[model samples]
Structures are given as structure tokens and as C-alpha cells.
Target: MTKKRALGFGYLPQESKHHFLLVTPRSPNEDVAVYERFDWDESENQETGIVEDNLRVTLDRHKWNSIKDFLTTSFNNRLKENDVTVGRFKIGHVPIERLLGKEMVLLMWAIEDSDPQLISTAIKNWSGLSREERWWLFTMANAITGHADDKRGWRKAIRFALTENPIDDEDKSQVNMFEMFYKNVK
Candidate 1:
């Protein structure tokens, strides 16, 4: 008869005559027992929590490169599309979260593309706009590049852009004239 140990959830595999098996108990009440002439301790048993943590860390480190590549390819494809262009400016000012829907995408791409350095240079050149402007620009670039989807958010942003500078009397007259001309054309 093979010697068996209580595994909490079930019985541990029985020990054989020639070899000893090390088994971990599943619950607090279950006690681990050696099947043959071998020493075992509860501390040596792998804790589920520790194993999960190690797995998460390993996945995060190893998978980051693959994720970056996928995002870069996808973003490049979107940026290359013709319909989304707005006079050489593909991306417009919009919230990052609204466009990308995931902050991690932006963070990963920014890190991989050395966007921080580029951003720093842009900030230096456009010193008038604050950090918010730089961050917004980064987000807008990602959104425009198709790394993120921000159509709804873009509409709202457009409204804000148009309203930012009040229409001057001269511009208003030009707009009215254009409207009348378009109406006549119609």
C-alpha cells in the first residue's frame, strides 16, 4: 500500500518504495507528508501568491517589446492613411484618454519612440505653450496616428479651437460673404 498525505483539496499522490515525492498542502488544515525516506517542509512549498507575482513580473518584462512593436505598426498604418490629414497636420489637439482609450499605449510608445526628448525639444521651441501643451501634443499625435480613436472627443476639441479666438469684425464679414456666395452657388 502506498502512503498518502492529505492535500486539503484532495489526497496527494502516494509514495513509492524507491522514490519519495514532495507534495504541498493546499489548505491550512492539510498537512504535507513524505511518501518515503525524505525530509520536507511547508516553507519549501511554492506559495500560489508568490508564483503569480513572479509570473506577472516575467510577462510584463518579456512582453513589453512585442506590445511596443504591435502598437508601432498599427499607429504607423493609421498615420499613413490619406483621409485623416488636415493640411499636413494629421493629429489635432484632443485628450489622450479619449483618443487612445488606454494610457499604457501612449506610455509604451512614448518610451519606445524617445518621445520625451522630442517633447522637450518642442517645448523649448514653442516655449509659450506650457507642459500641458506638450502633453496634449503628444496625445494628439498618437490619436492622429491611429494609435488611438478620438473621433467624438475631436469634435468637442474642434468646437473649443474655433471658439478660442473670437471672430474679428473683418473675419466675420468674410465668413458672411463666403456664406452668401456658397448659398448662391447652391
Candidate 2:
């Protein structure tokens, strides 16, 4: 029988683990681009990378109402502080739902930036709504505080209410609440 040639195994050495390169290309006019590369075995936790940091706060049924109340108050306070006039008279109408999300995001960023006073203001303002209201408000708040486009954000918020799994039975009940609120207003 003719001796069979070993396949392509000998062509290249085994690739090393934990080797990752992140590269940014220089402008088109530039001939050489600078690149930074990292090569180190990541630990299990590093690989996982603190999943909790990415997790949205979980508001169960018992906590839902209280949280909602707090957000409502915060939102109202922010509206007042900003002096945003809404109605026919140009008097400020509290966009409580909108404010809640903005305040929360601001507060979160403030905490990250080590601004204790802002955090305290947010907390104090947030203490107004009932827990259930606050929970619903948070979902609304996330939409507004997320992207800059208000109309797009509102639509997204409505979609999220219709789709994403809610924290509890109470949350599930609030799914159609936005639609109802808008319908009644119109």
C-alpha cells in the first residue's frame, strides 16, 4: 500500500490562548497606524466581567410600588427645577415619568462620578411616587434617559412595556397602562 501523506497539521503551530488585539486605524492620510494589543490569560471572573454591573435593577412586586412613587416624585422635582413649560398657558406640567428616568440616569452617573449632593437631591425628589408607580416610571425613565430622540425613546418605551419580561405580577399588570393613559388623554 502507498504511504498516506499526513494532512496540513505541520503547516502552522498551534495558536496561543488569551491573545487579543484591539486596533484603531489612523486617518486615511497617515501611512502607519498605532495599535494597542493585550495578551494575557483572563481569570474566570475577568472573562465573566462582573455581570451584575450590566444587570438592570430588579424590582419585585413588593418593592415595585414604593420604587415607582420615588421616581414619580423625582421626575416632578426635576421638571420644576428645569422650568419646562408644557400646557397652553406655558405653565410647567410635570413630566414625572420622563423626569424619573432622567433623574435616575443622572443619579447613576453622578454616583459614578462621586457627586454625593446630586445623588441626595435625586433621592429626596424620588420619594414622592407610590412604589408601583415608581416601578412603572422607571421603565419610562429608562427609555427617555437612554437615547436623545424623545419620540423614538417614547416609542421604544412603549414597545418595551409590551415585550420584555416584567419583574412581577404587578409589573405585568402595568403593561397596557401607558396605552390606556394616552388613550384617555387623547
Among the numbered candidates, top TM-score falls to: 2
Clashing pairs in 1: none
Q: Write the per-residue lDDT of candidate 1 for residues 1-186, one digit (tens) a residue.
A: 332222221112232112222232444344222122122234554322132211100112223433434434443343334222111101111111122213223333333323233332322232333336435754564355422123335323432332232233432311234665798998
lDDT of 1: 0.30
* TM-scores vs. true structure, each candidate: 0.17, 0.22
Q: Model 2 over residues 1-186: C-alpha lDDT tens digits? A: 332221111111123221111111233232111111122233433233323222322222222222334544544444445443211101111111222333343323222222233333334333333555545654564444432223244434433333331323433243345666798999
Stretches of candidate 2 off by over 4 Å are 1-115, 144-186
Candidate 2 lDDT at 72 equals 42
Candidate 1: regions farther than 4 A off = 1-59, 82-98, 101-186
lDDT, residue 34, candidate 1: 18
- What local lDDT does model 2 show for residue 65? 28
Q: What is the C-alpha lDDT of each candidate?
A: 0.30, 0.31
Output the TM-score of candidate 1. Answer: 0.17
